[model samples]
Target: MKISARNRLKGKVVDIVKGATTAHVRIDIGNGVIVTSSITNEAVDELGLKIGADAYAVVKASDVMVAVD
Candidate 1:
């Protein structure tokens, strides 16, 4: 899926935690890297986001503020 946001991170789905109305999708970036995002239940089911699946974590923020890590 394409989004207007430029800060998009792509990875393979590693884990999925389902909740009452939300689900957490975990993606493996590489070299033991992992990132998770909270998505809607409908998105989880519609996109078939599951373990060992390819997915893109597109992050859209109202502001693009940054700080030194």
Candidate 2:
């Protein structure tokens, strides 16, 4: 699917921290970089997101910013 988030980071799942109802997902964006985000447990479970899996990081337009310097 096409997303509007400009900072699209494709990475491998490195860690999955579980919460009461949500999951703190950590992905390895290569070059020794990692990104973390919160997602519903159901969503992650439904998508079967696990360590070593490939996934994309999507951020909404309202959640992103591009500053002109």
Q: Pick the candidate with the highest lDDT.
A: 2
User: What TM-score does model 2 achieve against the real structure?
Assistant: 0.81
In candidate 2 the C-alpha lDDT for residue 50 amounts to: 89
- Model 2 / residue 13 / CA error / Å: 0.3
**lDDT of candidate model 1 versus the reference:** 0.82
Instruction: Quote the positional error of residue 33 for candidate 2 in Å.
Output: 1.0
List TM-scores for all candidates, in order: 0.80, 0.81
The per-prediction CA RMSD against the true structure, in angstroms, equals 2.0, 2.7
lDDT of each: 0.82, 0.87
lDDT of 1 by residue, 9-44 (tens): 778999998899998889997888898888888899
Q: For residues 9-44, could you state the per-residue lDDT of candidate 2 as single tens digits?
A: 899999898899989999898999898889998989
Q: Residue-pair clashes per candidate, as listed?
A: 0, 0
Lowest lDDT 10-mer window, candidate 1?
A: 56-65
